[model samples]
Target: MNILLAVLTSAIAVGGTLIGSWSTYLFQRRTAERAEAVNREERLRQERLAAFSTYAAAVTELKRGLITLWFRRRRALRDQDTREELQAAQLDSDRLGAAAEAAAFRLRLVADDPGLRPLMTAISTHLGAISHAADRQAVIAIEARFEEAVTAFIDAAAARVQ
Candidate 1:
């Protein structure tokens, strides 16, 4: 009878140890999964932030280039030397436009907010209008709208990333 009692006690202890170990393993696995999820979210936020900022900078540069090209082309009509300057400005404008387009594509890929796409496109359309603006007043008007579109995009992006 004593030997049987001893065997039963040992079996109970072994069973208890197994239960404890299993519980601990489950807890640790859950914690690790939570941590991994948080890390993934942070990484996505960072990528979105980088892509948005890059796109904004690229578009702003393109806007400036377009305005400069517009003014230079106007001057070229009156001055011979300005024609050479106009060509250089045209080249610069083309490069900036390409960079802005590439940045737009990157932004589109990373952007979670659906509203941002139209704002991005609006800025592009604004820049195009500026390139063909009939007068300084027209360019100035488009510039204001361009700024508004950019600001809207930024606000939407900020809300999304947070």
Candidate 2:
């Protein structure tokens, strides 16, 4: 009877040890999974921030190119050299515009907020109108709109990153 009691005690101790080990493993796995999920979210947030900044920078560059083109066209010089220079500027402006569009598309892909698309469209429309501005006043008005759009985008991006 004593031998049987000893065996029973030993079996209970082994079973308790197994239960404790299993519970510890489950708890550790859950903790690890939670940590991994947090890390992944952080990484995605960082990627979105980078995409927003890149899109903003690209838009700024394209705006600068368009303004330059507008000024060059306004000069209305018809000499061969002037015409060549204007053509080159136009090509450069086109390239910058394409780059800005590509950046905007990338931003769209990563943006978490649904409102960003309309803001982006507004910016693009303002940018397109800049070259067609008839006078300094028109340009100024378009520029104001452009600046507002840019500010709105920055604000939205800041909120998202936070």
Listed in order, each prediction's TM-score against the native is: 0.90, 0.89
lDDT by residue for model 1 over 32-88, one digit each (tens)? 999999999999899999999999999999999999998987887767445668889
Where is the poorest 10-residue window by lDDT in model 1?
75-84
Candidate 2 global lDDT: 0.88
Report the number of the highest-TM-score candidate.
1
- Per-prediction backbone clash count: 0, 0
Candidate 1 clash pair list: none
Residue 90 in candidate 1, Cα distance off native in Å: 1.7
Compute the lDDT of residue 25 as modeled in candidate 2: 100
> What number of backbone clashes does candidate 2 have, counting pairs of residues 3 or more apart or in separate chains?
0
Worst 10 residues of 2 by lDDT: 75-84
